[model samples]
Target: MCSRRRWGTSPRRGRARPICSTWRADWPGRAVPTSRNFSPWRHFLHELAGVQPDDPVPLDDVAELRAWKERFPTRLEALLGPLPSAVPPEVEVVSSEDCGRYRRDKIVFDVEHHLSSPAWLLVPHDRETPGAAVLAQHEHGLGRGKDEVCAVDGGDDGLREHIRTHRSDYGHQLAERGYVVLATDLRTFGERADWNPPHLYACDLTHVHAAMLGRNLLALDLWDLARALDVLCAHPLVDPARVGMVGLSVGGTVTLFLAAWDTRVKAAVVSGYFSSWASSAAVAWNMCGSQVLHGMLGRLEHVDLAAAIAPRPLLVESGTRDDLFPIDVARAEMAKLARVYDRLDAAAHLEHDVFDDGHRWNGERAYPFLDHWL
Candidate 1:
């Protein structure tokens, strides 16, 4: 006798049905019944398994790499929808202060027609001529943005603890090293969060609203960052030819994409955010609306995006104890990216700094890497 088991109730009939009915039970000999619990998350994981790009661009050699660079940005821009038009970033210096080793200037600048951004411009007093410059990107936090990167004095205990833990004040560090650093607030963070509802993250609401209008939060951020670059380059102490970028977490995401898309960024240091998308998707809160691009998973991965920055000096930093972005996955992805750099004969230009720490700015190798490259 064959054992019968109830599978699921029928929606229309509202009756329980045996997983193995007579017809299914025997055709030539017998049938096997497979049972499993239903889970949307599990289904999503299954869907993501072994996914690859529909039209993968080649990265075999210099020519192929160049072709991939040319072709991939178009595909990426499509996913990003449209970007705002370029405008003269009418940079205005709001105020300036002489902080021990460097001068900190509060400035405002235009990003788009009606959009503007505020930032901290740190210039080292020792710099005698126009020298290397860096666009320092800040991580995500409540009542925290460029302030964290610039090491501003006041914030909530959480923000301070985060700064202490992550050593989040790399912009100030760069200034001490004689690089003029521009750290700006991405939209929905710090001073830009005025439109946010009480107790709600501004990025969530802005991402939702932008999507409704066929825009993307990241695209908007990239636009603003580009304009910020205009202001950074236009500074008397900055040489446009010697520009680099560095960021961690959400800041790292923008750093990676912006370096890939814009040629002006001569070097980039991406920290705390270099693992695969599949790895990130496993954790529910690891991804957000602002970081998403429509239909990106099947078409691209973090390796591909990082690879696009190849032939250009890039240093990727990963922390062993960073649970948010697992170190093992970052190592695996970096291995894949290494192949692209090798094929381009730019292996020397690529470096991975795996540190014994948590999700934070490990600039042990980063400072020297930028000095060597920029």
Candidate 2:
């Protein structure tokens, strides 16, 4: 039997009524209510998720863009909540080893007072000059975490399969190209995944605790990621002026938000997760609590928040058949980004590639995009 449930986005109103898929099993072959005849609130949510939402682009001018940077983050804060300010991340390199073309240093660093991050710092072997760097991000690969991007030994088989299937080892690939690459486990993945929650769902509890502590998962992750920027800048072999970031799935969510919040990122490649938040989060219901920014729909959609990264080099990559993040919505967001960049006279800095593939990392334009921007 299908259980009936309702969700309220605002305190006084239920803005959407998303049906559970349980009905499919309750009546094996009976025709069900199509999404076409969904309630008005659900349709509104769908419109927000699709290209039909009313996000009239703000006029492109120096004044508006400047004001947007200041105002937009504040509005986003209303959804994602407050974050601890940036602090010196006293880094501790735990171990180092040569891996042929590069040496990987396993390290720990503090994001703020209470939390610390474990990361792999990949440096070009037998090199000395300061060069560009990338804060490579990891996706939600069935179950694989940061290792999916770093391709390190001792990773779980699922992430290993994720590596083989998606060629998700962009961090190692970038390090071999002579750029310092920092691949850190996000809040609830890899080393971070093992949590002492009072619930069965560890990831869900972490995000819940984050929200109860006055912020959502995205806010907390971005705060720590900005601190990762501090660590990247402090490294001897990294040129502080030329830092970029890349991620495939949830990692792309971080790349988008972090680049929007932290100005230090000079360039970014967001793969697999640049769709309309509504399209992916509202419709598919495939997002983790870590991806939630409660009630983000009313203020600014994905494209509006991304405008904070305008005038900087950014490349959005998406696959045509990605089940989680549909390419159709990705193009809509891309078009909005292009309009904002074109108005700023920095159109060339923004590029998006829709490759003919599925929901995986297609690194065709990623390396070149960073090379040109950095």
For all the candidates, what are their Cα RMSDs to the real structure? 5.5, 8.8
Stretches of model 2 off by over 4 angstroms after superposition: 1-56, 59-66, 85-87, 155-157, 195-201
Q: Which number leads on TM-score?
A: 1
Q: For model 2, how does the per-residue alpha-carbon lDDT over 49-140 read when each residue is reduced to its tens digit?
A: 44544433475566766766667766666666677866668899899989889999999999877789999999997569778999999887
Colliding residue pairs in candidate 1: none
Backbone-clash count (model 1): 0
Query: Residue 285 in model 2: shift from native, Å?
Result: 3.3
- Any idea what lDDT model 1 has? 0.86
Q: Which residue ranges in model 1 land beyond 4 Å of their true spot? A: 1-40, 57-63, 155-157, 195-200
* lDDT (Cα, 0-100) at 130 in candidate 2: 79
